[model samples]
Target: MKYNNQRPVVIGVTGGSGSGKTTVSRKIFNELSQNSILILQQDSYYNDQANMTMEQRANVNYDHPLAFDTDLLIEQLSQLLDYKAIEKPVYDYNLLTRGTETIHQEPREVIILEGILILDDARLRDLMDIKVFVDTDDDIRIIRRIQRDTQERGRSLDGIIEQYLNTVKPMYHQFVEPTKRYADIIVPEGGNNQVAIDLLTTKIRSILMQRGNDKIINNKDSTI
Candidate 1:
């Protein structure tokens, strides 16, 4: 199906590590037609560290805003908004650097940008039509982080705990948590808040419909 010429609606979802921002993003993506929506993860924009030693890359604080290649992300997102395709980067968690492969992403009607520090950048915030913050407790976040790192990222429980204490927790308080004030909607308990998810999906569908109607009106005017 051909989407209208209208630019994609960008929704920003942010929260601390293991705060269920990814879960929220996936829930919204599932609610929409799969073909018309895409989820762009900020994790994919981590600065390439191929030249660095494994130890150096490992020591780099992944939770900090500086760890991301934000400029590249902004450029690629702009391309998508212009209804263009982009080669999205793939990050290797175990390698602690970007992978060699690229994923070709087509422009979609809806784009969900999910990350911990998405709201920390003003330029990113400007691109978003809606901003959402997932508010999960620190204890809950740490538990989730431990599970994800161990089960998916091949990280040891001891290493995860040490990193969380040394970097993630401090960075969240200094950078990520403060950005919650910028959010248009604050969702307590992240994806578990079904009412918020429903409301968000309804709003997104409404915008999509309005854009469709506008496209029809524009076509009629051109004929006249």
Candidate 2:
């Protein structure tokens, strides 16, 4: 059985834009016991766009580490580690702005924080019990980005290419790629690699079971 009161195992899933970090996160989430895991997106903690005009927001280099509200993310994760719930912000992809409402997240045994630049900060790195980076070809990632932005976010193909050229590619090399050295696991081909996913699932289960067993032993010992 899963331990409800056990402290969460914070897992940081990071990769370049369209590198399939989200897919990998979802696969891991699916494998974990139901109600025992929660997935948090770095996209949700984007710096609010209220101060800037839509034109300004359009020009913003979102792929950079500076674009994320890392301070707030740190605080939220700290709360999760303490077994406290959080009101996570929600971002609107179409408007490139933070939404008026928030998402209520309960503490769980596994907290999966998925994003592009998550590993770019040292403090954030310190909080992760496990860090995973999804590695994919640049061509494939750009194609995925183009398709998603155009189809889902109502962005034009030209606009996607412009932003990818001006911001995404450069930021990936500078901020995203360097962080790969910090990852505990590097998943190639993203979520389609069943071997990697299976190995990761096993590792997570082992960690969870070990922690659960330790808690039970401690409780019995304390009563004696």
Each prediction's TM-score versus the true structure: 0.93, 0.91
- Which residue pairs in model 2 clash with each other? none
* Model 2 C-alpha lDDT per residue in residues 36-56, reported as the tens digit of each score: 677888989999989899999
Superposed model 2: Cα runs more than 4 Å off: 1-6, 213-224
Best by TM-score: 1
* Cα RMSD of predicted structure 2: 5.5
Query: How much does candidate 2 score in TM-score?
Result: 0.91
Q: What is the lDDT of candidate 1?
A: 0.87
Worst ten-residue run, lDDT, model 2? Answer: 215-224
Candidate 1 lDDT tens digits, 62-118: 999999999999999999899898999999987999999999887777889999999
Give the Å shift of residue 140 in candidate 1. Answer: 0.4
